[model samples]
Target chain A: MNIFAPVGRAFFTLLAQIGRLTMFLVEVVSSCFRPPIYWYHIGQQMMRIGYFSLPVVGLTAFFTGGALALQIYLGGNRYGAEAIVPQIVVLGITRELGPVIAGLMVAGRVAAAIAAEIGTMRVTEQIDALTTLATNPIKYLVVPRLIAAVVTMPILVAIGDSIGVMGGYIVSTQSLGFSSGIYLKNTLDFMKNEDVISGLYKAAAFGFIIALMGCYNGFNSKGGAQGVGAATTNAVVTASILILAANYFLTSILFAK
Target chain B: MTTPKIELRGVKKRFGPKVVLDGIDLVINPGESLVVIGGSGTGKSVTIKCVLGILRPDEGKIFVDGEEVTHINGRARDKVLRKFGMLFQGAALFDSLTVWENVAFGLIQGRGMGRRQARDIAVEKLAKVGLGSEVINLSPSELSGGMQKRVGLARAIAADPDIIFFDEPTTGLDPIMADIINDLIVDTVKDVGATTLSITHDMASARKIADRIAMLYKGKIIWHGPVSEIDNSGNPYVDQFIHGRAEGPIKMEVRG
Candidate 1:
């Protein structure tokens, strides 16, 4: 037997998981046509993954937008052009920081919670109980979170983008010596609708990643309390990394011009 | 008198070098209660997991209603699952849902009943488990352990399943509450006339609920007999386990 066989097998297993995730998307898409949706479960997940996420996303966006304005104004001031702060800050927040930061914030908050909650259920055999009750564990447990993530993410990003732009406007008009109307007009003039749309699309993808990582680690969790803690940690770490990586790929394509 | 609800033959499961179940054989006759008893980590839970298809065995055959069900998946596995109910070890009521909602989950999700109809059944089952309608709207976490177990029991029988699996049904209950739950199990199963395969190290529960008892040791069933014949099983392993002795043929592994 080859000495490197274990390493090769581990790589193959990762590939297999990715392949299965692809198949799972197909399954979820098909199920969208099926009637009798688990509305209650979906609503519950929305409260967990979406509504509770607002504070973290909002605070992060506000601070990030403020910091961006300060940094840009300081850098551009050397050339006697600190006036472009609003335009740059709005574009930076809407096109990049808003979605990416929101994604990372959600990864830290929601993903770890999902992993811990579901991992506890898995270790306690609640998932098995769902199966025994003739409820498909994936459809019942996973699909709700996925649907909530997909549906709520765009909304969160939209909110974050608006709030972040406002944050930049606050700093620009007050601390940076730009008129409110001029700052607003500059942001509108410089950025197109494509930036906002692109950000929302990335948010949706990040939501899927957050939910997927949470469910995967939770579902495959082993041992008990220690295992659940580990799964929660892994879910957050993996989700944050993937969100950053996916953000880079999305940005490249969206900003290719 | 009727066909067996579950049958296992030469069932074995192993993880790396550790074997959990080894060459097991069992039959659970329809409408009868069969309890598997053993010390901690003796594969009682593993046996139930194998039957539920949560954990697949390394080798064996499992039959439900005389049909081979070991290797099935997707729709086939679901079809098999519809015949069963389970009460988990820790009262696995979804913390997110209300007590009534958890009980009605299978009815609404699996059977596609309207919320009104499912909630109606949920209330009725909860009443049967001695939980009032006032408690129905409350989250499961709000309830006490015995009450959570009651809710779990209520959920298990909510679908009126043809078969039921209860894992450590009374692990954390007081003797009176344990007896109450045991009695409820007996009453509800009789009302539905469901086949049950329960696993518990609790002899009082086994004696109260099981028509027959099987003792597991070192991943195999070393002794099995009618509950009426348990004390006289003449098997040292069974004696060591059921009586909670630390000596005899079975040695308690020293934890690191």
Candidate 2:
């Protein structure tokens, strides 16, 4: 075998995958602009992706916020900066932990579900059936999920942010012996609207990543049960990785001095 | 002379190093049922898919209603597809949708019919396939294999399409259910006055439903004749296939 054959093959395979994904993204974006928007389907997806995902996202954010407070308290104690817990906790939860944690959680929940559902549809020819029935599968399947995730993720994250902040406040005042009024005052004083807004922006981007990865994997899935299962796992893993990667770039862009 | 309802001229398709269809040419006259019979992996499905525009042929032309449809896409493809209906091997019903909704899906989604009116038409079509009103509201997942095939047939004829394609319609069913489905397909095609192109390995299904039969071997139509003449076609491949013989001119690919 040629020394460079394997490398060349791998490189071309990567390029081909990128090309296919770009085309898929273009189709999805183009379809979104077209008419016959299925508002009913969109609403249903919002319920599935946004509403049903709430408790998990909320619970994750709550625990994260509480743990963050405890950690900050312990670490700050070494420097006689224990009182900084409220400000740091609020800032961390709003600006980073809240959106990222909720995103990962929903990536695990919603992205896997979307991939499994659509992948099964593909293997079973229901997607083809949709095409034969005159319904564009992208319009009926991908667009609704895409629109719902983009619209609802920020809302979900915003709610999660609130719950997270509340968790921090409760843990600090109740267990850390911090005064409730002082903690609230410090949290509000330390946090800028931009911090919260940036997180919401990240939430929206993460939502798009999750839905795109899921739909892309699912639509391209072949074979049968094994294919669907692989698609589901791939969707969650790829979406979670993309969320984190996008978060870094978004953070730099949004918060650069 | 009127043009054949659907015609394939020297169509060819390949997947990587493997060639699924080398060169295929066939025709189905208006309102006639043509069954393309072949063993597994003979590109029978590929032939139907090429004509349906699901898979594009690398060479040659496909004409539906005398119009060249080889390279059509977008809205033009949809317009071409509107004249066609298909029942896939596994019924392919939407598990999310109820039986009636599956039947009326094309009407509502494709033709812009209101749900209520589409539902009414769906019920009527379902009844034609001997399904009662009670089954209409049930999900396809709730139905038996035979019942799902009936629903599939109902959905196929729901739009009264100009052409219909059946891809192994009797697959995964008991022999009795298979015969029942074959009878229903014959009756429904007659009711709609639709041309049909079906592909199956089952000789019984081919005999019962085909007006004209074509045998696809190695991606080429090796034999084509009227159903009555299939018995005396004198093609060893056809004889071996119909008789389900393991030892014949057509060798089965098996490993010890």
TM-scores of the first chain across all predictions? 0.91, 0.98
Q: What is the lDDT of residue A189 in candidate 2?
A: 93
What is the Å distance of residue B56 in model 2 from its true position?
2.3
How would you encode candidate 2's per-residue C-alpha lDDT over A1-257 as one tens digit per residue?
A: 79799999999999998899999999999999998799999999999999999999999999999999999999999999999998998899989998999999999999999999999999988888887877889999999999999999999999999999999888999999999999999999989999999999999999999999999999989889999999999999999999999999999999999
Which fraction of the native contacts appears in each prediction? Answer: 0.80, 0.65
User: Where does candidate 2 stray beyond 4 Å?
Assistant: A1-3, B254-256
**Interface DockQ per candidate:** 0.68, 0.77
lDDT scores of the candidates, listed in order: 0.90, 0.93
Give the winner by DockQ.
2
Tens-place lDDT digits, model 1, residues B47-149:
9989989889889999999999999987789788888889988988887789998999888877779999999999999999899989999998899999999
Compose the digit string of candidate 1's lDDT tens values, residues A1-257. 88799999999999987897678667766665565467878998998899999999998999899899999999998997788897889789888999999999999999999999889999877888788777777777788898899889999999999989888889888887889888888899999899899999999999999998898889878999999999999999999999999999999998898
What docking grade applies to model 2? medium
Highest TM-score against the true fold, candidate? 2
Local error of candidate 2 at A244, Å? 1.1
